[model samples]
Target: MTHRGAEPPDGTGFLAVRCDVTDSRQVDRAFEEAEAAHGPVTVLIANAGVTHDRLLPLMREEDFTSVVDTNLTGAFRVARRAARGMLRVGHGRIVLVSSTAALHGAAGQSNYAAAKAGLVGLARSLTREFGPRDITCNVVAPGLTDTDMARALTPEQQSELLRRTPAGRAAHPDEVAEAVAFLAGAGYVRGAVIPVDGGAGLGH
Candidate 1:
């Protein structure tokens, strides 16, 4: 589900419904609408995320909770909802879009890091729970992607990250999407954490 109305440029076989992942009702309704339009959902990508950057010492309780609620708990809501249809069909793919911060913690991002880290646990646990049913769960951890979120980072932050990255540049959004697409089709690659971070998360 997206937060804004979206339509395919080609305008065929696509419906974009605005739904908030943090709300269970919205999550259910979104799935209902999708299923109504195109039948039961066989693939789910839990990609909703938000950041509230602050050092642990300076972070407010809400900062931590809100990030976790949206990034981690929101994933849970959608994954759980999608599992129902997958269970009936006995086949599915769930890909969670995590971050390199989840593997190598970023300074001033304790909340975002923790929330993303939780996704690994959730995906692995779901892998075990759903494997017997022919369902797979995986995570894609991307770093410094060329997206609005990455652009929002200060130039200094971007420079520091690029300096650390062996490839010396940010990833294209399509690079991350490629990994997600691979996971969706690879039935044997369950509970894996694929990093599309241009080696920025190497050795972590």
Candidate 2:
């Protein structure tokens, strides 16, 4: 599902359903459409997020709430819906996409960091609640991925961050996706936060 209803490239066998994570009805409808076209959803990757960077003092209430609503609450909305189908099947996998900012706070990203950090707690709680039924939930925290978000950063900002990273480079998107794929297939790995940050968050 995507907010803009974007389709995968031809031959990918993906269905592009328009759904906004912020709306419960949209979440439900997307699942219904997916299930109708394919089957019950057994794996969910909650990756919807938006960033509104600002210092705490300069951030408005809306700024903080909007980020949280999309990043944290949005994951919650979709996960709740997906859990229904997983419960019926008695097994499933959930992977939450978090970020390194969650572990090592950024100077002007309190809202984004808080929301991403919340994902860890959410994954842990879901693991406990669903473990007995063979449902596993985990988080993958990626740092400075080579995505549009990273590209949006100024060159100097990117250079500064890479200098701090042990690898001195941003991660390929595939690297992060590989971690998610691993978690989805591993039955025993529950409530684990696997870092795919090129050692950027090694201590954390």
Candidate 3:
């Protein structure tokens, strides 16, 4: 998901380009197409991710690498390409979607957690390198959300999760989107980890 606009006179809306972050070629082409339609990408939301949860003893090496490649390295690939255009224009906003598990840890999601945590480092480095050029980078860490992903949990499981969350409920997807929008619109904020986790990751 990405946003690029300042509410046009008619408020038409944004363009949605499908790009496979795992494929560098596809990522490059997506940007080219978007640029042709709108202009250089001024805001990018690197939200491509996948989860492969398994206990460490049972986790296959392929599972770990695959998640990291798509979630962590995939963001790197897309961000690297997007930075080219942003640097040329001298302004941009980069918001990467991470997970609460990145900080709190999950029972069977070591790979996913590690990959998400990597985004924090990536955003910070980008902030340092691009901040001087009027670009900002940040992370949005979401907790359990009312999405297909959250539906995977059973009723009992969902209840258990809510019991632990201070909000006592799953977040609506729009709630997460709102945070991303705020970061995209903010110019002064840079390299910040803004968690929409319902206070689940307070200490971290």
Report lDDT (CA) for all predictions. 0.91, 0.89, 0.86
**For residues 1-204, what per-residue lDDT tens digits would candidate 1 score against the true structure?**
455344435545457776888899999999999999878889999998889998889999999999999999999999999999999899899999999999999999999999999999999999998757789999999999999899889999999999999999999999999999999999999899999999997777
Off by over 4 Å in 1: 5-13
lDDT of 2 at 56: 89
**What does candidate 2 score on TM?**
0.95
Number of the candidate with higher TM-score, 2 or 3: 2
Clashes of 2: 0
- Candidate 2, 1-204: lDDT as tens digits: 454445445665577787888889988899999999878899999988788888889999999999999899999998999999999989899999999899898878999999999999999999988857889999999989998888887798788789888988999999999999999899999899999988887666
Model 2 residue pairs with clashes: none
Sorting all predicted structures by lDDT, with the top scorer first, yields: 1, 2, 3
How close is every model to the real structure, measured as TM-score? 0.95, 0.95, 0.90
| Model 3 lDDT tens row, 3-54 | 2233224444666666777888888888998999988889988887788779
User: What's the residue-level lDDT of 57 in candidate 1?
Assistant: 94
